[model samples]
Target: MISTEYVVSEQPFTVRRTVKWGQCDPAGVVYTVVFAEYVISTAELFYGCLFGQGPQQAKDKYQFGTPTRGLTFDFRKSLRPDQQFDTEVRVGRIGTSTYQLLMHARDMEGDTVFTACLTPICIVRGQRESIPIPEYFKEKLKAHQTSDAP
Candidate 1:
């Protein structure tokens, strides 16, 4: 069974989002791919809030880049256009050169619409070589790490 223990974070970063017309299909339901986009954007926002800099600025100033190495999502409910939702992002796991982000999007009723896990590797921007996560960055991520128990 997939572990649900990782879903509970000590400190989660949340972003409020509204589904737009362009993100929906003819059926008025959000396109599946758009969920992935939401996760990516929320990850950027998480980093921005943690470091006080945007993705590009982080790369330019730190010479390090975080590129998604893997992503997986579970859809529970269809989302409609103009519906408001909240995406909660937490640090799932941190490794030597990679970190996993757990993201869950919930509708107004607090029901989970979808969940995603993103594995991003820290790389040297120019060389594209995996590198150890910076101490400062790792510490910041630790603050968001999920708890062991549900």
Candidate 2:
């Protein structure tokens, strides 16, 4: 119920979303847990941008998988119901078996709401063992990589 309609952009890899009633708590502020959902959903859509298809579909077609290795976030502002914000996605560090997806959420006034980093480790399908990141995936991420991040 956390996900509402979101707009995705490939040029700079951004997702725009509007907070909904379902996403907020009784106190009229977004639930703390919802931030995690926002991050994961944005990452899924980012995969869609990279693969030119749905994220799960791409994973199935490629016969590979990315499992979350780590996730961290820093909240700068509170989001209330009916608020709209932009979650800009930037490709961060690329490692042998893991990569970082940096997501920065900014409010309508251009103020930062939150910043997150999602590190997903690559692995062979159906296996827990790790593998080197595929070249295709690396190249795609590099095309969108950015150096400016705080």
Candidate 3:
């Protein structure tokens, strides 16, 4: 299992989720696709905390949206229905128009069950063209950067 103590120690933005029956495969482990959805949802919550606004609000107010450029995850342990875990999201890297978000989900015992790296690009809402990250948003993301992510 991946050690997540350092990541959690900093108290990064987190979201707790319980694996639901519908999210599991016949073998009772969480379906792989569900993990991606969890990451996306957690990222939304992370952005909400960082910007004081959710995804929709950011688009409406700033005319910019963060769309996933790429995503990758490693499943360290299986999650069964009813299992509760907390996903912690931290800034990994901030680029001109893209930022890398790292996330790890730990079980009640604090063992990492899954880890993900997601690249999201800031884009002009209507044109969907990449743009430099807003200065204020960049500052907030930098504040959450951690060097201990796995």
Candidate 4:
């Protein structure tokens, strides 16, 4: 038998952006890839709060930041550029040196327009390989998980 470890918890996150002129397709719907950027941006905000500053600012201090290892998205509905959407980010899993950030984008009517998740690896400064999550940062992330739990 194999044992598995994957924890999932949902948290609220909001995003408001008008579809750019070039972000829409012939159908005038937002491109699927656009949601991924929103998801990443929202997740970065959460990470920023976890650290002492924004994601880039935190990276400036530590000389490193979590880098996206993978991204997956499922498009459920269509969105127009005139519409703004809010996203919810959930921690789907936390591994020895990586975490999955799940995001769902919803319109004003609370309909899901898109869903995405990003797997980011924790790495050392100026290095390309993975590393164990720092003790201080792990504690901080755990606290964030606990506080957002229902």
Candidate 5:
């Protein structure tokens, strides 16, 4: 008999994305604002990968929330419709209640398309109050932290 299973990859989390026509403007270039959505979506997937389940549910079960503290992007190559890229996610600075997710998007030719840093603070879920990073969550992030991460 054959079985199937899913495991969290030891390497950094990565997602492949293709630019669809709908994601472009009349000029056929990806809209500037849409890149934020791509970064956020990738972060959610990274969290889900760590927990072995959906990210929101895992956050809810832990009674904590990760709300964005800051988001910054550095655009390199402009991406047009039909262009494919890959985003690699890495854990960055982790503080008492805040952590950073650094994402790098690269084109098929190995050129950087964009880079983003998403900083989210841990809070008591639904309470609007900051909280320390949960032990298990911290452990998972540490496992995938970047070499320069603190």
Candidate 6:
């Protein structure tokens, strides 16, 4: 029911990280959970590029950061320490108070090490209030929308 193909036409966003010893297991392969962290990291970078240095700026205006409410990852391959991986993030679905990010990790050879979709919701933690996405974000997101089919 969901589209699996990556919509490359959307603005390409990327962040790179080298596999650290602490992030790997005895086998040298990166821990499974770290893959998701890469997704979250790059998504943050995406927001920073669009709006400001961090979500706090947006939160000041919109009252919430993008908090991951759902996550799904498909490990196409494994990544080992001494190797570098870059996370590619793409705008998926943008809504009034939520957005979906399509994220992937690729190795030096261009092999897809992992792929995932993360859905983040805007929520004011203490008050437990959810606010609509700000107009500024919507306008910035338009620059990253896909014009071609994935």
lDDT of each: 0.83, 0.89, 0.82, 0.68, 0.86, 0.71
lDDT of 3 by residue, 1-150 (tens): 532211123356778887888899999998899888889888877776776766688766988888899999888999998888988878988889998999888899999998899999999987779999999888988888888644
Minimum summed lDDT over a 10-residue window in model 1 is located at 1-10
For model 6, residues 34-94, the per-residue Cα lDDT tens digits are 8776776667668777866666676666666667788998999987766776677766778
For lDDT, the strongest prediction is 2
What is the Cα-based lDDT of residue 131 in candidate 4? Answer: 87
lDDT of 5 by residue, 21-133 (tens): 88889999999998998888888889888999999999999999999989999999998987888888899988999989998888989999999999999999998999999
lDDT of candidate 5 at residue 87, scale 0 to 100: 88
For candidate 5, give the lDDT of residue 130.
95
- After superposition of all CA atoms, the RMSD between model 4 and the true structure is 9.6
**Model 5 per-residue lDDT at 82:** 74
Segments of candidate 2 deviating more than 4 angstroms: 1-3, 148-150
How much does candidate 2 score in TM-score? 0.93
- Off-target runs (Cα >4 Å) in candidate 3 are 1-10, 148-150
Top candidate on TM-score is: 2
Higher-TM-score candidate of 4 and 5: 5
lDDT of 3: 0.82
Comparing 3 with 5 on TM-score, the higher-scoring candidate is 5
Evaluate model 3: give its TM-score: 0.88
Alpha-carbon lDDT of model 6: 0.71
Provide the TM-score for each candidate, comma-separated. 0.89, 0.93, 0.88, 0.78, 0.91, 0.82
Residue 28 of model 1, lDDT score: 98
Per residue, candidate 1 scores C-alpha lDDT tens digits across 46-131 of 88878876767977798899999999999999989778888888788789999899888899899999989999999998777999
What's the true lDDT of residue 126 in model 5?
95
Q: How far is candidate 2 from the true structure (C-alpha RMSD, Å)?
A: 2.3
Worst 10 residues of 3 by lDDT: 1-10
The alpha-carbon deviation from the true structure for residue 36 of candidate 3, after best TM-score superposition, in angstroms, is 0.6
Q: Estimate the lDDT of model 4.
A: 0.68
